[model samples]
Target: MDILAKERKLLELEKQVEALGNNEAVNKLKSEIEKYKHNEMTKLTAWDRVLLARHQKRPTALDFINYMSPDFIELHGDRLYSDDKSIVGGIGSINGVPFTIVAQQKGKDLENNLERNFAMPHPEGYRKALRLMEQAEKFKRPIITIIDTPGAYPGIGAEERGQGHAIAQNLLKMSEFSVPIISVVIGEGGSGGALALGVANKVLMLENAIYSILSPEGYASILWKDASLAPKAAEVMKLTAYDLEEFEIIDGIIKEPLGGAHYDKRETFKRTKQAIITEYNKLRRLSGTELQYRRTSKIRKFGFFQRFNYDNLGGIKR
Candidate 1:
């Protein structure tokens, strides 16, 4: 069974055991549940981690912002177009350190999802994020970005507004920013939508999160002409945090609570907060020139590969 299905069955069993009013049975079932969780979490597949990252009850960007910075002041508008609700940018302080926080916000329910376009941002959303980061740079505050998006909106209206240009601008400006930039992948980090805000001195991902150029379904559809083979595609995509860390695509992984972040949100948030702080502490010590150099160097090294000689078998080189 899938992770969600197993979790549902476990919940139902726990409820039934509690309803029986036998303390001994209840205690025994709880212990078994804990054991099950431990075993399952240890062997999660890439697709399993995808499900956990996109869990309905998973903590959203606003949730993390509120928990980490109670006094956050939200800023809106791109100054060039209308404010896009899918992207939320603001100024906040975490542990007394000021930061400009930009996050892609997903709705918790149907209505809210419709309103936020299911976290699929438009060109204006990227512009808004760029504006906030520019402001942060001016004020000499660190910038923190929370990424969780399937991709940028592909609608005609979004394209009419120069969607690609907006994303490109953010990447170029972010690379040159003097202030420290740290990006955390909290969920579905897909396509340029995620990368638009992902140019950072240090990139991190939650243990269960997945970061990829595109979704597994999309990859499967393109390669095999069947979206149903997404699970198989996930195995080949190398999108999991562990895989990305091994590839040096991400700087570190923040451990999630057992089962997923939704299972223990408070603990998850606490760990995420600590990870951000730790990374920031290291970045803060560097000068503006050093920060820029570090960020550009990191970006330049992406997709690097070692050359191999193959002239022994055939006079061909790859």
Candidate 2:
């Protein structure tokens, strides 16, 4: 069988083992499964990493919370319309460091994904995120945002409810917060939806995650009239963590497990937690105003280009 088929078989076996509860037989089977994982995930290309980022077995924000933070108390509601499940935020402690954690939740299965709108949050979600950030600021607790959205929901309901305004508001307000803000792009960080929660003193990306204005498929459809050219688009877009790290678009990278995060959840959680702690500790040393200035400075330094010298065009004849 192909690697894809083998992966599916392994996933099914894992579910069966889970359903049967733990046993010596199950433990042995689990060990056998682990042996196959490294082979299944061969050397990955950018497009392969994209596929892995969207893999159903991959851990999401809630998974990271459960593994990395204890005593998490989830807060709900935008207080205007209703609570948006796509964006999960609350108070939590990471190794006893109090923080307000906001995360984009892309559900585990099709039914749950539909329920969370595949993690494309609405206006209320952004509003809800801002509300939580303000609370974090009020309490002088640090803020950490996990960004994993395809983009802000562009549905009529979301637009009518001021989705653009809501995201814009978050960008403006989060910058003024008097507490440390660290944003992690754990998966698909797309456009303003990702940015709404990403105005942070430090921005981190998982090794396999992609952060960009839009998906490669979307980029291809708009520019090349064919979504199948997405592989080519992915290369040119420079959305991978490695690319972003070189461009200084992100503060640092949380290295994934050998095959990917899905291959080993515990290791990924450890790496992510360490990256957060290290970066946050550095930001914590700075005063609130200094944090804001550094964040603003870091953002402004991105994507600048020098004017072309037309006067020196076509190579001088000297």
Candidate 3:
């Protein structure tokens, strides 16, 4: 069985051990669980991490807010249109330091997933986020964004409402925002939907999270004409936290609990809280112009290239 299965079995065994009042069995199971958790972390492939990021039991943005922030007050609507529930934003305090929190919300079950549009946000969702961000900037509060989405909703209604324009506007505004912004990719960070909230001073990822321009399935379908080749596409895309961190695409990775974040919700929360606080403290030292320059410089450094000599130009005369 896989590590997740083993972990679940251990959890079940522990519960049964409590009922049986067997100390020896409980100690044995605890040791096995610890060993399994440690070993599983080293064995996970990029695709395995991707699956773990999307695990149904994984902690959500709201969960993080509850654990990391002492108090939170959710703000709603784009003001130009209706509220989009898929993206949630609010003002909250962590250790008495206030921040504007913005993040995507995936459903806990099928009914709620449909309600959240499977975390595929609409035009209004982006707009709502930008609005909150703007408010944060006005108050000089730092911005914290949590990304966990498949992509923007590709529905006809969303398109009609100008989805592309909304995302583009956010990219532009966030880049120019004068306050510090910290973004965390908590799960499936796909396409422009993810980028909308991801342009920040410090971009962090959960160790198991995946972030890419598109889903591996979409990439495989487009490039290889085979949706089943998604595993291959995932390997090639460099979407894992370790790969992205190596390339300096993300500022840092918040290490997940052994067996992935889903295996230890409170531990995940603690790690996330600590990572955010550490980064935010660093950013709080920079001036507004410094923050803007750092953000722009960081974004501009994404893709690597080499200068080619004129002699090496193939189609031109020497």
lDDT of candidate 3 over 115-134, digit per residue (tens) = 88889999999999999999
Candidate 3 scores a C-alpha RMSD against the true structure in Å of 3.2
Scanning candidate 3 in windows of ten residues, the lowest lDDT window is 309-318
Model 2 residue 306 CA deviation in Å: 5.4
lDDT digits (tens) for residues 239-265 of candidate 2: 899998888889888988866788889
Q: Can you give the TM-score per candidate against the true fold?
A: 0.97, 0.86, 0.90
1 or 2, which is superior by TM-score? Answer: 1
81: Cα error in model 1, Å? 1.3
lDDT of 1 by residue, 12-101 (tens): 877887787768867887889778868867788888898888899999999999999999999999999899999999999999999999
User: lDDT: which candidate is best?
Assistant: 1
Worst window of 10 by summed lDDT in candidate 2: 309-318
Model 3, global lDDT = 0.90
| Model 2 lDDT, residue 159, Cα | 97
Overlapping backbone residue pairs in candidate 1 total 0
Clashes (candidate 2):
0
